[model samples]
Target: MTTAPTPVPTPAATELSGGAGASGTATPVPRRRTVKLRGGSWLATVPLFAFFAISFGLPAIAIAIGAFTLSSDAETGAGTFTTQNVTDSVQGAYWTSLLSSVKLSALTALIGTVLGLPIAQAVVTSRFRAVREAVLSASGVLANFGGLPLAFAFVATLGNAGEITKLFHLTDHGWSLYSFTGLTIVYLYFLVPLMVLSITPALDGLRVQWREAAHNNRATTLQYWRHVALPILFPSLLGGYVLLFGSAFAAYATAAAMVGATVPLISRSIADALSGNVLVGQGNLALALSLDMIVVAVVVMAVYLPLQRRSARWLS
Candidate 1:
């Protein structure tokens, strides 16, 4: 019987073992000192750090401080410090606006997910290439066409005595352009596209082999999706919903154009407070509003982190 040849270990392994240099002798590798960054390199970054500190951090910190500071009045000398600013914000219109914002965000997320899923399914399963391209392209265009332009389009299409109303009797009717429902519709227009973009990749990642295997086992299409597809797609859908919620929650210009100062969504309320028209020296209200917005953003971000982790685990 022939003996198998001894396998040679790699150089790296040999080195780790101290390299059998002589018959029984092992050569040791001299450890090199860790490299240290020069003071110049650290100094170079100071300007960049300073730039960010001045432009971004400082302004944000200033706003935060101002939100807690009381302005000088005839009674108060130059400046004063009090929690009344925050208290005032929490007790008044701010509370109503915050409640409205949260409600609208929930509605927008629901609408976007419900609408986008069907559209994504159409894009994926439809037979016609032209239709798919048109739908995708139109979604892209409309996603970018937010804010004032979108508002005007809605007005032109559905406003009182708009072209549609005059030509086709499509009155603003029960769907007036100046209501919370109207803003929800406008938000969905942009939000659905966002959902489509987010969820399409997750849908595309559903392997054909899995579907085929399920089918060979006599699984129906719905059964296959239920058992094999949805489990994988759920995390992504949840993540997308969180994202859409954030987007709609932060939206300002579109709500402004549509409501023109009547309805007080959080963003509109903040803008009004900041415009210095109604609340001149009380810009602190705007800051407090910003803080409220920040809280909402933080919640969304907190939810997003776990959803992202789930997505990564699923994808892996």
Candidate 2:
């Protein structure tokens, strides 16, 4: 008698259905798992978002709300909303203080931009990697090495009784480290380094091919810079200027430690208002001053962001 032959199963069929075991019992087939990718929608960012909301969003909103609200007794919290505080902030002494901060910030920002651009260019063009590394390292350090320590260092190095002051007889020459000029000079110590750090990438973005092409056109160095480099670099330059301006405008500790109330900075004025050094129950005024600062900061960011995006296209 002819026995019925069992047909061999194909690999696909064996995989889909279970394969036979050595004992001739069919094995269980493995199921396929579908993976879901967790993009930004995951809960991992919740903590960070919550922290930011608490730390910055809350405080900024409070400041904005408080700016329009009048101050009441210490226990009563805020009073009715009014524009008095806002108006007061832009008038008289507060106005002067704001203008003073702007002048100082602009002066230092321009000076830092001018001084730093060449230094950045030199570093980018340098053949020695060590030179570039050292310069960039120094810049990073100096840019961050500000506030009280920087103030004290400048005082000890250039103050009335300082070693350099005595060596150069600067006091006799009326070079007061407690004045506007001295404050500016001290600001430059950090500002220039900041400029170098900010503009180095933009300078590096200046391709060698641009220079070669300029040379091919028989352009001189000055002509190349005027026609090719400066035009391209202008946005980055303006962006750096705005950056330096913001840095100087917001600086408080250094100016306070060095020049005190003589400079009339907006930050100092705001501090004075908060501390009741000017008047009691002036928290409303402090809030207003803070609001003014916020406005200025908003304007700076508005200008900076666009320029930064534009520069990135050419430089990046």
Candidate 3:
């Protein structure tokens, strides 16, 4: 009994042996795999990038290249480098069309903002959730409710043979649905809704505390809006104006189906040129007009970006 006792393995030696086993054999440890996380992040965006390239980037490149090139002959269909298309786009009737487009866009944007702001404000402050939901739903539908069907609907509602026109005729009044004014009226149908959609979030972003503070200072409702609210909302308002302007400017189907080519909008002119209805060698001119539109859009976006950023600072 006093003989030397058998040495027992320490806990550290047992752990190193991967726990005690009846056979006293160590279990093999599996090697850990290190996953690389860097390269795969961009994989998700590949589809999006491809889509953008095919849809927008390729077409834009073709338009730019075509704008600077002239057809050598109608039969040969060969292109030669030239800048005459660009010059032609900015001169004569084409220039007038551009100006007309600009004017129409500006007018629509202004009118839409003025009419939409109140509707948005009302919706934001409404006591009824159902009313707010209805307004927003209608605004969403009407905002995008454009194109040929929209034009047809307007024509049926306001054209010479339209109900409104007949009603006005009954009252011994005249109404024209083919004029610039008439086009503007048709444009308002979609434009006002677009404005409502655009400004609603901005209006909602207005904090209640600001209003309470204004009231605490004994400020009237008009005074509060004029000073505190207007200043905060101005950036969003301007951004919405730019968005509406772009919408009206880029509109083609609605105007084309509604008034034909009677209105000399830039988009209509571009269509005419591309359809070969204007003149020979005018295809490049169509691209030039498109380029002009792109430039105008770019400028509009440049202005909009800053205003949108400023608005986000408060709204967010």
What shift in Å separates residue 151 of candidate 2 from its native position after superposition? 1.7
Q: How well is each residue in 1-316 modelled by candidate 1, as lDDT tens digits?
A: 9999987889998988888864969887889998887787889899999999999888888778877777776455355677787787766678888888889998899889978987898787878999878888887787677888988998888677567667766543465667887778778889999888778778777778898999999999999878878777877888888888888888888888888767777787787777876757667778877877777777877877876777677666
Query: Which structure is stronger by lDDT: 2 or 3?
Result: 2
Worst 10 residues of 3 by lDDT: 167-176
Candidate number with greatest lDDT: 2
Tell me the tens digit of each residue's lDDT in model 3 across 285-309. 9999999999999998898788778
Alpha-carbon RMSD of each model: 6.6, 6.2, 6.2
Candidate 1 segments whose C-alpha is farther than 4 A from its true place: 1-59, 73-79, 125-134, 167-173
lDDT of 3: 0.90
The digit string of per-residue lDDT tens for model 2 on 1-316 reads: 9999998888987776678766878898778998877775768889999999999899899898888998675786849889999999999999999999989999999999999999999999899999999999999999988899999998898998888999999988889999889999999999999999998988878999999999999999999999999988988999989989999999999999989998889999989999999798888889899999989988887887887777777877
Residue 147 of model 1, lDDT score:
88
